[model samples]
Target: MDTSALNEALAFKSYDKIADICDNLMLQVASEGVAFQDEWPYAVHLLGHIYINDINSARFLWKKIPVAVKEGQPELQAVWEIGQRVWMKDYGGVHEAIREFSWSAQTQGIVAAFSELYTKRMFELLVSAYSTISIQDTAVFLGMTEEDAANYAVQRGWTVDSESQTMTVRKHKVATEQKLDPSKLQRLTEYVFQLEH
Candidate 1:
């Protein structure tokens, strides 16, 4: 496996190419079997790295790796842990886990830029998941003051209760028009709302 080449691509953040490589590897696995002992787990981990900010993709990739391989590589397991932490809305835990996870010389190059990128993404995820979060937690996570957090939250269409110093995310309502089923309706109105097929 040309880990150097893969690492280089990841270091440069060429996600499309990384995704292409992952697709090709998975195709090869399907056609034959594990071409190399290490390739399967490595490809899955690379995908996890590509989707460091995306927990669902990270989890899907984690499940794609065989259980035995997951045991052999704790770091790969750590990657999944990062994703899980994000999913649980533990932004601080995500950052802490990211920092605690070991980065090999091979991995360091690829994952170096992920710290800040991942941290910001975790913050965004937390804001989306929690209607209210402690102002201190927001301040610590964002490295900003409560007032700044309030400003940022409001800009993102969220509300903050000043007295309580809690942030609240405003949910966007999905707009849908009520359309009577033509088959169910006994008679069609003169003006019927017809969806574009």
Candidate 2:
């Protein structure tokens, strides 16, 4: 997919727009028997990120948070609900629906495997971010070899302090006032995923 296609797919402000794009992408992957390795998961994560990070959009989508809390549901449940809504809106609902819109056995298997791998990998990355994990520990957690972990860190431009047994993700000081472009980052992510694809 081209950058414009990605941008168009992600720029969807309506559920129908996103649903169409996602359903198409899923169908393409299924027909080709190609796994949804990189861009696929990144696209899903990007949508989740946008929902949580975009003030206006997220404000609208997350309105149920307080309602869920008032009803005495767990906060995580609320978050999960939001996530589910985002997924359903963008991706033509869920697995059953996506599967029902299937292609062939090989294609279906590819899509299923890709979805599992993408979600698992994303969860591993998210969990590591919230925990004090060693490189080897995170490598195991992500089901990646140590070299793959190191390579990813390098790609992210994080400094590896081997002697200290830690890799420090360089933080930009607000005082310096630098910003990363969301679209650029998305492109980089897409490009990386395309390599695996």
Candidate 3:
């Protein structure tokens, strides 16, 4: 199978479209009755799922990969390590895995993208879930050094108590309650009445 398209997609950081591209290519390979020759595409496809925060899909893909391919390709194994960390909600492990692996040029962009997205997600979760959090925990969650995490919290308008080494999160303002649509409610009531009758 020609890999130019997959390479092109990676070059442009088109992560969202990678699964579709790989699926179509797999189909094409199957239709032609040829075995998969390259392992890089599989690695890219798996990382693409990770980039989109689709752990289940990434797990499914991992299961589908042949054992030999999984064993032979360290990059693929590294990608799966990140997926495992994500599945376990081991944020520190995720950062550690990303840092420890020597990612190839082709997969680097998607891995970096996933790292940034995951950190952003953790930041949002911390903001919503914590009134105040310790700098060490925030550093682990944000995949940053303690000093960098402290600075990041301050930059985001969070108040850091230097003596306590804790940062007060800036909570988002809760939106006012949305007005229910009368027509939808009336239809639902009529449906319930009809069902009861």
Candidate 4:
């Protein structure tokens, strides 16, 4: 299988494009009645879905993979383990799976990118959901050490009480400005005038 396109996509960190590329490749190969010469593409394609947090799609992809191919590629299996953890909404397990894998050079970049993106998303969610939360829980949620989590909170303008071991989330107020379109306002005014008449 020619992986140049996929490799190029990975080089650009265009993770969202990977699924489409792999799907097209698989379809073309299937139409030609040929088996994949390599299985790594399947793994990368699944990781692409996972990176996008499309757990449903990742689960579907895993279900469609041939058992032989899945078994033959430990890296693929490792990716699936992360997908499974994600499916179960197991944040800590997701980090554990990532840490346990000895990913090949081909897959390492995407894996690292996924880890960074997942941590960022978790941080945003925690900030919105919790006003004050335990440092240990924050560590687990963000896949960081307690000290690191505390430090990260502090950097984000959150306050950490050393005695209580809890961090207070700093919520920034968003300013909303509603702008009305002139055409729409005029149409609405005309309609109201007609109704009054």
Candidate 5:
């Protein structure tokens, strides 16, 4: 099957199309026991950049590159370097690589993927830093309406306020059984409360 379609989809910024192709590629590679052969490395590289989104998984795939190929192709090494930086949450390094890495027309999607990944990491950091975030802050960060921000946060288990100014994590009540051991239950309750924060 022609998995190169993923490359084209990525170049055009049709990233949503990449997942199925990568899945199919994985199945095909698994069924055939294809290791480091016939564009498998490139496909894995694409998965690393565009789909896997984890340092260890991508690094695992990267190690499968044939020694000869790893040494012979400069672009492969370059791609690996760029992908590792992205996986490491080094957005500034990625931005510098975008300008400095010799990107051919065929590889333009790597830039887009890196940019999206960096933005996603930034958003994750921004959200994680706050227990209670205002709708205005959410709207500004996401470029959406306050209502949309509240809706989004609510869907993700955050509680929208009466004034709709902030979204806090929804706290669940601990239902303790009176019959259970009191000491163990108190410790469990304390652990649960600690996790909420």
Candidate 6:
């Protein structure tokens, strides 16, 4: 399959198409796994996870659209709808109604305006976590220091655990459930919630 097709599908910005494409890709991945007779590898799952997370992040960014921007750019609503369709397709039997993070609708509702802002806030928390990077083999990916990074996350309503040095992101509905599905898509969804506090 053409990998570029995925890119094109994502760029479409129609929620239905996005969800459909996501579902198609996911089905392909599953079929490939079955053909190889191997459990789905971590890398494959990671790819799906990244796809979902990035879109969610985009959704989050969509929220910052100013009132003037909305009025001036009514076409944005169509773009967002397309994106939702493309990104939110049900993964197997994971979702009941719309193809969104399991708790997304319940947590934030389905209204585009509300979801846009919610997604943006979630993205902020996520970006804050990568303020700095450390390479495994003495390599380095310098960025904002851990302190500053943590502070950045904290500003977005996350509770930075200085003791454990581990950040715990809270979701909208379920506060006790810290972990999400092991699949990459699930991980991305959970990660955003983790960053959001």
| TM-scores of the candidates in the order shown | 0.56, 0.28, 0.86, 0.87, 0.50, 0.21
Q: After superposition, how far is residue 27 of candidate 1 from its true place, in Å?
A: 1.5
lDDT for each candidate structure: 0.63, 0.45, 0.88, 0.88, 0.62, 0.41
Candidate 6 lDDT: 0.41
Backbone atom clashes (below 3 Å) for every candidate: 0, 0, 0, 0, 0, 27
Q: Candidate 2 at residue 100, lDDT?
A: 42
Deviation from truth (RMSD, Å), model 3 = 6.3
lDDT of 2 by residue, 1-197 (tens): 32344345444433224434554665676688875443343323223333333324434434523453425533233334434543444322332333344334322333344345443544445344633335664454444566776566556555566765555553333466679999999999999999999
The C-alpha RMSD of each candidate to the native structure, in angstroms, is 6.9, 18.4, 6.3, 4.4, 11.7, 21.5
Collision count of model 2: 0
Model 5 steric clash total: 0
Candidate 5 weakest lDDT stretch, 10 residues = 43-52
How do the residues 1-197 of candidate 5 rate in per-residue lDDT, one tens digit apiece? 55677667766676555645665676776788666364553633554444446556557656866787777766666777767666766655555555566666655665556556655554565566777877777665543467865786677687877675787855445688768898999999999999998
Candidate closest to the true structure, highest TM-score: 4
What TM-score would you give candidate 2 relative to the actual structure? Answer: 0.28
Instruction: Report lDDT (Cα) of residue 148, candidate 1.
Output: 74
Model 3 stretches with alpha carbons more than 4 Å out = 37-40, 177-197
Worst 10 residues of 4 by lDDT: 33-42
Residue 4 in candidate 3 has what lDDT? 81
True lDDT of residue 193, candidate 4: 100
RMSD of 2: 18.4
